[model samples]
Target chain A: MTTTQLSPTPRTTVTRGRSRAVLDRDALLAVLAEGLVAHLGLATPGGHPLVLPSAYAVDPSGPDAGGTLYVHGSVAAGWVRGAADATVCVTVTLLDGLVAGRSAFHHSMNYRSAVVIGTARVVDEAAEKERALGLIVDHMIPGRSATLRAHTRKELAATAVIAVPLEEASLKIRGGGPVDEPDDVEAGVWGGHVPLRLVAGDPVPDADAVTSGGPVPPDVVARARAL
Target chain B: MTTTQLSPTPRTTVTRGRSRAVLDRDALLAVLAEGLVAHLGLATPGGHPLVLPSAYAVDPSGPDAGGTLYVHGSVAAGWVRGAADATVCVTVTLLDGLVAGRSAFHHSMNYRSAVVIGTARVVDEAAEKERALGLIVDHMIPGRSATLRAHTRKELAATAVIAVPLEEASLKIRGGGPVDEPDDVEAGVWGGHVPLRLVAGDPVPDADAVTSGGPVPPDVVARARAL
Candidate 1:
């Protein structure tokens, strides 16, 4: 309660304590890029919110100006239809640390997260939409567009792509130690951080990966190492 | 779109060209429990949708009753306060497979997900609130509760807990190989399955873990392997 008045940009409600509100775009973008799952928030026609886990990427408008978030669903997805018309909200979070406390009630987590609030303009045009697809492909495998077969017109029709512009976004992130309430700290609970991580084991190439194939690609290895 | 009309349940959406939308309670529970993160959908005080990424669990009740979901947030969380009196929509999703294709347009993910629409009730009573916190603690670390200190009365008062009964929930699941749009199969795109996993490394106990400070505990090592 005292935090709301003392801390600037204080969230109206302090759900998850002071730890939930992440600040700024640089921190947000880092969280988004490092994380794997994304939450696509859209309004139902009846007015309730629909939040689904989705695979996404931060789109580059190349070397200038702002970026857009790229997300996709089946053309038949109600979420896409929901996204096509309304101002959709998107979020990506990575749980980086699990804070262990002396008491059950005092336990918490430290995480890096990105939350974006924007209207999704459905990419309907052919050329611009290709860019969205490229962002998504490169998101999973860098330099994949040049290596893979291009999309045909029919395949394009079934995929629905929505581009959420990178404006009006904020990241409320908290990382580091457990801010245990004073009384709870000396309660003699095993207190400290259990550092959580996203790690990669040896790559299992496709069963049919070419014998002709070169060494495990540097990009894939780099991405896995980064995780 | 035609799937909505054909579904035997309430408000079932189209499963798309390939049957990706599955409607089952068992499936929903699996998806919600498999992943550690949940995109908790709540309405912001501003009346727009706010999707926060948090941790959650599907808590099944005794023999005659069904399960409910437990999601935690800051006592003063802006969006959570919105859920206290209104219908709350909570969704949890796990991305398990990457359906790669020769064509960029055909890339997809193997996913299992759950969405629950329910009214959240505040855990007002002290005894019940304690149980809720227990669920959250065990949700993160299965057998660690008995090993930790219990919360003090003051710590309990500072937390807010809410439960959303999982009665009117829907689950949509998709898994398996790439549904190559008829033409791209021969395009020689390296495609099949790239499985995603959450693995644990050797346990690293707190620096001051034991009052006497010995080697890492066997219990921690066993838990890491289980994860």
Candidate 2:
């Protein structure tokens, strides 16, 4: 699949010893799209924090400030319903591993994370809602949407899609080995990032899959093979 | 290595959730200990949410409240310094993948997550602070401290160790497969949980290591060999 189109948004953080405190809009959007899941935090019924896991897709084509990002859920759910009033925050992260520095102060890790925060608008229109549904389905199984049964009108009525323009989003990244104090360079201990990764394996097709005889779709195959 | 220890002081919100969520102190601590990383979230300047990545080690035995979870930072860092005043949340999640069902709504993912919300306190004491630092080192690498340079007093002071008591913590989990609508049972889509896993592979030792003419630690070696 093509990488999501991203807009150019400048970063505002200053550097502290090579800290990658800034990443432009496209990099942030791509990181969000590469993700299959996101941890969405919102307010609970009693004013407590409520976090839910959800699927999301990047709509790199919506808002004027920065392309909007989309996340959908049930309309009555507190998170989706409260989107307009409360800030909608969704975070996607990829963990690499432990960075053992020679000095205790220099320890760190390698990770990629994007935090998108903005006001959300419910997609009241029918066409965009259906399209959003398709995008979600495709997100899980790229070409599977074309092969699945169509969503019933009742099902459509129960879902809610919200668009958050990624105007205020920012990305921070850290990688490489531990940045140790100058004197501890020769501490004689193994100190560096132990690379962590999420690797996809060969697909295990379902017993009742319709076209099991054919090779996996290039997209699916490519994704798996990339691992 | 032993897992991070959980505090016995149970709070109301921490006790919420199903049986799976009601883990004993050790159980909660084990999940955090075995897991290599955490997704740390804090409120942004605008009152929106911002989550970044950080490596953390639980202090199983130093403090009265199950020893604070030791997270490091630059002394002048604003977040670590400000965490004590605001609600700081730490989330550790292990995703197990898409649990697909005939009905789209029945889809789910099996995951283990520990959500901890608490006021953080900066560890400023000289002796106790060193213990937190050791736990963090051992947490990352079982026998690491004795393997490297010890922390100097100045380094310890400059490095902030912020601990959040696990009292207000809670855990949520969703596991198992698709519970499809009866009508969708016969729908011809390959449906069931696509099991996901993080497999450890062979460990390639650092090119420059003073191994006493020995192989990797048996447990670490076995972990890698399993994959």
Candidate 3:
């Protein structure tokens, strides 16, 4: 049962920055979908914390409760092995702009971020794992998966796909210009924000593709233009 | 004594993607300096791992065994309080491009990332804390702190700054086009990369600044153009 409102568990609640906390589940989904990279945090066997970047995809109708977030890594990676069946935190952040204030204390960054805390389990089933891998590839480049062939048995075996539920998640957004003190704002010091975005350059085909004399695929062109 | 090469401890070593591991200390510093936000991973009091995004700055000649990386947070934040004098992992990633391979299994992202694992301590000294805060502000906008007034004592009290040494850090970089199987590349499939970069848009002055009829500062304009 998907809910419209985000039900933040006790640990997921935003206690300090209550003003920036967003309770809407759609906001959480938006932030996750817009972000390309996710930081996975989990404890190592020695009890030390480890954080690694991974490509991820979200499936609203996934098998996991509250939907599923798929994160893939090499099966040989120690962090991937350690994350199996363990509670982990996934954070995706999109920096919007740089907030310049009249006072050093007020300098900040405009951003949208989502945090999810849940137990992650490795997907051992072949069918589910293949579907998750395809989702991840499509997440990066929409409609490109249909153009590619199926993954071989060896390739599928070499990857470890972990799924985490999106039940305990929270979103935070801070936008607009700097919020300076009244005195600072009146002091005539310059205060504003520099907008930032992730942009993509033209696609460069590889030697083989160039030699093959094939034009860039429509999906690849569309993805670059969309960015 | 700053070493020229990164001295990765057993845990910091990149065993899975050994080909991408960069050992030069300068490369590690470059990656850290280029990134504005860092994902900090640490175990909560309840032993569950948590990852939070924080603004960070790198100091090459600071009062730490291997220089220092300063990360600031609100004093009221639970994550900040939990990170004090605790082991933590900080990861900063800059996505360079999307690697489009001929096969689904070969799709990947080209990125440069640095991971630092160390014990973080909250800055207590007034002078050091103030300097760290200035660095953090300047890291976002060059010469920004000079235009702003000093931080008030009350404001300082409300902020918590944590410093982690640059020791035990490792960097990974994946560049160029996708590496696909011979069969896939020979099948006339398009393969290449779409370069991605964080760009800055025009500066938008605040209402007060617009009303004051003051031009955007040179530093702000230059920063935007540089991006």
Question: Candidate 2: lDDT over CA atoms?
Answer: 0.60
Q: Write the per-residue lDDT of candidate 2 for residues B109-190, one digit (tens) a residue.
A: 5676777777667877877677777777667666655555678777876788777776666555665555566566554545
Tell me the docking grade of candidate 3: high
Q: CA shift at A85, candidate 1, in angstroms?
A: 4.0
- Which scores greater on DockQ, model 2 or model 3? 3
Clashing pairs in 3: none
Cα lDDT tens digits, model 3, A1-227, are 01122677777888666778666877788888889999999998888798988899999889977789999989999988898889999999999999998898988999888889999989999999999999999999999999889999999999999999999888878899988899887778889999999999999999999999299999999989999
Q: What fraction of the true Cα-Cα contacts (under 8 Å, chains A to B) does candidate 1 also have? A: 0.43
- The C-alpha stretches of model 2 lying farther than 4 A from their native spots are A1-18, A21-23, A43-52, A201-227, B1-26, B61-67, B200-227
Ranking of all predicted structures according to DockQ, beginning with the best and ending with the worst: 3, 1, 2
DockQ of 3: 0.80
lDDT over C-alpha atoms for residue B211 of model 3: 84
Best by lDDT: 3
User: Candidate 1's C-alpha lDDT?
Assistant: 0.63
Better structure of 2 and 3 per lDDT: 3
Candidate 2, residue A115: CA error in Å? Answer: 2.2
Model 3 agreement with the true structure over B1-227: per-residue lDDT tens digits: 01122686777878677778666888888888889899999999889899888899988998987789999999998888899999999999989999999998899999888889999999999999999999999999988888878889999999999999998788888899998899888788889999999999999999899988299999899989989
DockQ per candidate, 2 decimals: 0.44, 0.28, 0.80
